[model samples]
Target: MTIDLINDMIPPLKITDDATKALIWMEELRLHALPVIKDKKFLGFLTEEMIMDHNTVDAKAGDFLLKGENCFVFEYQHTYEAVKKATDFDFECVVILNDDNEYLGVVVLSDALSIFSQSASIQSEGGVIVLSLNQSDYSLSEISRLIESNEAQVMGSSLNIDKNEPTKFRLTLKINKIDLTHVIATLERFGYKVVAKYQEVKSISNEKERLDMLMRYLDA
Candidate 1:
């Protein structure tokens, strides 16, 4: 859960704190923005730019109009939910609150992305298959069965509406095996439209190895 990724190192701004104090904290912490709270409840985010624009050495934190007041997620929510909220609000971090709506901590964008890169689907050796399907024809269970019959498994999958064709959608499946020839043929035999396929390198040994493989892939 996202609660596990909460970053408690960055302290929140107190409503009574002045702009001078906020600016100092921002510089020391190396963050562009910090959350403001009153009585353990989140108010909003205060940015360095907001403070600098005011040009007040002693302006109270409460005097500024903070941003991302509604940009938050409960601690029990999924990590992807935090990512989605950050994307929707265009905030660098997402505030986390408990069931009582009290501030818990914030999840920085970099940490969240790091967790995703280490996920099984992204790190494991695999091949990606992109299929074009009608909205009504989409069914993961059916697709998985077909892939399984070909001695392969769907490690992960994502769906998106085709912008060029509103009536159709694109399904991207990440297979655990590097060779997708059998899987692609099985899907096509089962009336699935195989639009594209790409093979991936085997499981990486370490961060440096993973990065080296990525660089080589990019160069290719």
Candidate 2:
């Protein structure tokens, strides 16, 4: 659950607080927005741009219309829900609430992303392989069987349409075994085109690199 990912560093702004105070918090925390709470209930979020647009530095947060009222996820919800809310509203962070809709805390997007990168399936020591094949030829069961024949299990997999070819798809798989020499040969013998492969030796470095690339992409 995302409850554990709640960031205590992001203090909520009271409804009575002025926009100037909100701006100060935003600046100090390097955030674009901050949550507003009243009597333990989440009112919404106030953005730096919103304050600047209305020139309401001295106005109380409740005085002006707030944004991202729905930019929140229940504490027991999956981390993906938090990521979805942040992305859907272009928010820097998402408010976390309890079952009764009471404010708990906020989860910064960057923090949630870091946790996602460290998920068991992602951090597991494994070899990754990307296969390019026609959309019509996709068969996960067959693929898994072939991989198992090599004494390797498919830990996880993702399929996406090949950006360069409309009719082709890229199937990326994470295998349990670090040594993929036999796996690759077995796949190729079955006419599966292995487009890319990442051996286990570089798993640590590659995970860090992937996280860095994702952060850059999000910034852009």
Prediction RMSDs, each to the true structure: 5.3, 6.0
| lDDT of candidate 2 over 1-220, digit per residue (tens) | 8899999888999989999999998999999899999999998898888899997589998887888899999999877667767877988899999999999999988887777577555667778788889998999999999999998899767676786787998887878888899999999999999988776544444534555433322221
In candidate 1 the C-alpha lDDT for residue 126 amounts to 83
TM-score for all models, in order of appearance: 0.71, 0.63
Q: Give the range of the ten consecutive residues with the poorest summed lDDT in model 1.
A: 211-220
Report, for every candidate in turn, its global Cα lDDT versus the true structure: 0.82, 0.82
Q: In model 1, where do residues sit more than 4 Å from their true spots?
A: 129-142, 157-172, 177-220
lDDT of 1 by residue, 1-220 (tens): 9999998888899999999888888888787888999999999999999998999869888999999999899999877677767756777789999999999989986687776568687678888888889999999999999999988888877676765677998887878888888898888988999877778776666645544433232221
**Candidate 2 deviant stretches above 4 angstroms:** 123-150, 156-220
